[model samples]
Every structure is written in C-alpha cells, then in structure tokens.
Target: MKKGFRFLLKTIMWFMVITFAFVVLFKWVPVPVTPLMVIRYFEQDSEKRTFWKHDWESIDNISKNLQLAVICSEDQNFLNHNGFDIEAIEKAFEYNKKGKRVRGGSTISQQTAKNVFLWPQRSWLRKGLETYFTFLIEVIWSKERIMEVYLNSIEMGKGVYGAEAAAQYWFKKPAARLTQYEAAAIAAVLPSPQRYKASPASPYIQGRKAWIVKQMHFYGPFSYDKK
Candidate 1:
C-alpha cells in the first residue's frame, strides 16, 4: 500500500510539472494545432479526401469587431471573469436541471484552455482537466494572449479553424478586414460551427447574426488595451 501510494503521488507530481511547462511554453508560442482539429479530421468520411484550414493571426491582426462579437455572442463577462463566470454557470445548471435544452456556461478563458490543451468530448475527467488548464492559463497568460490563442484555435466552420481561415473561407477576405456584420455572422455560427453556414446564411443564422450585432452595438467600441 505504501509503495502504491508513493507511485501514485509521483505520477501526479510529474503530470503537474509537465503540464505546467507546456502551458507556460504556449503562453508566448502560437498553438500549432489542437486536439479538436485532429479529431474532426478523422471523423470525416474516410472515402473522401478531407481538408483542414487554419491560419494563425496575432491578436493585433484579427479584427476588434470579431473579438467583440464573440464576447457578446458567447461570454459577456469575458473581460471581468477569472476564467469562470459563476452566474452563467448557475443559470445553465438550473436551466439544464429543469429539463430544458442543455447549455454551457464556459467563459472565454475556459474555452481557450479546452481548445488549446484538451479534447472535445464531455466527460467529467475532461471537465476537471479543463478547469485545471483554465486556471493555469489565467495565471500565466494575459487577457490579450488568451484571446489571441482562442481566436486562432477555435473551430469556425466545417474544415475551417480560426478567425483568419474562417474569414477567407466565408467572406473571401482576411480576418483583419472583416466588417462588423461579417464578424457577427461568423460569431453567430460558433455555437454549431460545423452545422451552420457563416455566409449565404439560412434564416436561422441570419436571425442569430442580427441578435449578435445588436449585442455588439450595446457592447460598444472594444479595445484590448489594459486600462
């Protein structure tokens, strides 16, 4: 029992050490790829050739409109939270408990952690690791860096990843050049990137885009400069 306990302790210690180093390394480096990207590629039909598109753009190069649009559409408290938004979590929990459609309360920071360090499946272990990585990133990375990595790594459409790639894929323009409505359209499809179109929108995507644009207006002009 003593030997087994020591082995478990040592294993956990090594895991923490390695993961911490990994997170710190990514603080400055661009994330090359994500687990979700790989998983999605394999999930495609093997009979047909599959394509993957991703381009890394610095936070400065990505449009402020897109940054703000995602904040409005996904996490309004993104700028204020310490990696978690308690109120949103509570609401999602209550809503799910009431037998309504399930919703996620993840903050942008939390989503960044999962996208950068973990997989896409919804297991308790994955959730726990996501929380752990989220704390690590919030401690080691700046808000701008977190947003940069998030914008550069998240899946935006089928075979499309990141703001840069999504911009070109959907609008035939670079990420830095996307307009407010264009950015909102991209953000509107985030809830189900693979299932929805970011351009030539269906009625559902158009309505979501309108709502997100309204929210972005209320959010006002956005800047990542520290106040």
Candidate 2:
C-alpha cells in the first residue's frame, strides 16, 4: 500500500510539472494548432480557414456592437469578475435545479479557457483543468486579450470560429462592419451556435436578439475596459 501510494504521488507530481512546462512554452511559442482551431478544421471538413487576428486598438476595431452584444447577452459582469463569477454560478445552480437539464454558469473567460485549452466534454477532471487554465488566463492575460482570444476561438458555426468568420459567413462582411442588429443576432445564437443559425427572421432568433438588444440598452455606456 505504501509503495502504491508513493508511486501515485510521484505520477501526479510529474503530470503537474509537465503541464506547467508546456504551458510556459506555449505562452512564448506560437503554435499552429489550438483546440478551437482543430475543432473548426474538423467541423468544416477542410484544412484551411480564415482567422481574424487583430491587435488591440479600439473597441470599434472589432465592432462596438459585437462587444456590447456579447456582454449584454453572455456576461453582464464580465468587466468586474476575476475569472470566476460566483453570483452567476449561484444563480445558474438555482435555475438548473428547477429545469430538466443542467444549465451552465460559464463566464466568457471560463468559456474561453474551455474552448481554447480543453476538449469538448463534461467531466470533473475537465472542469478542474478548465478552472486552472481560467485562472492562468485571468492572471496573465489582459481583459482585452481575453476577449480577443475568445472572439478568435469561439465556434460560430459548423466550420467557423471567431467574429470575423461568423460575420463573413453569416453577413458577408468583416467583423468590424457588423451592425447593431447583426451583432445582436450573432450573439443570440451563441448559446448553441453550432446547432442554430443566426437568422434574424427566425422567431426564436428574433426574440433572443431583441432581448440582447434590450440588455445592451440597459448595460451600455458602462466601460468594460480592464487590464
């Protein structure tokens, strides 16, 4: 028993050390493959996809509507939270308790961590890794950087990732050119973008878009600028 316990402890320590080393290496080394990128590649059944890589300039550089719409629809307190938003999690827990299916309380940061670094599955082990990566990103990456990575990595559709890809595929325009209504529409389908189309005319899509628009009006004019 003692020998087995010592072996298990050493194995766990080695795993942690290797994981940390890889993370540090990846931070400095730009890899051609990311988890989201791989998923998109598989979804499209093609090897090539366009990714929008933009440096931070102004919110306008990526469409103020997109930024506002996401915050309005997804994370109302994105600017204030430190990686984890306990209040939202508590609310989600309560809401899911009343529902037939379990709901989620993932903030944009948490979503980014899961989408970019982990595989698509729900397990306690995956959740643990997601939490670790979320903490790392929140501590090391700026808020703008987190948003940028999220924008660049989220699955927008069957073969699409990022605002640029979704904007082009859905609206035939660059992400910077997305309109308020279009932005809201895009944000509306985000909960299940892979399964739902962001058509403004669809009843459910329209309703969700309207709700997001209202949220923007309620939460707009507040600066989400964070470091």
Best by lDDT: 1
Point out where model 2 deviates above 4 Å: 1-32, 36-60, 224-227
Error of 2 at 181 (Å): 0.9
Which ten residues in a row are the worst by lDDT in model 2?
Answer: 51-60
Per-prediction TM-score to the true structure, in the order listed: 0.97, 0.81
lDDT of 1 by residue, 68-167 (tens): 9999999998887889999999999998999767899999999999998899889999999999999999889888899999999999999899999999
Candidate 2 whole-model C-alpha lDDT, 0 to 1: 0.77
**How does each model score on lDDT?**
0.92, 0.77
In model 2, how many backbone clashes occur?
0
| Clashes (N, CA, C under 3 Å) per candidate | 0, 0
Number of the top TM-score candidate: 1
Query: Residue 209 deviation, candidate 1, in Å?
Result: 0.7
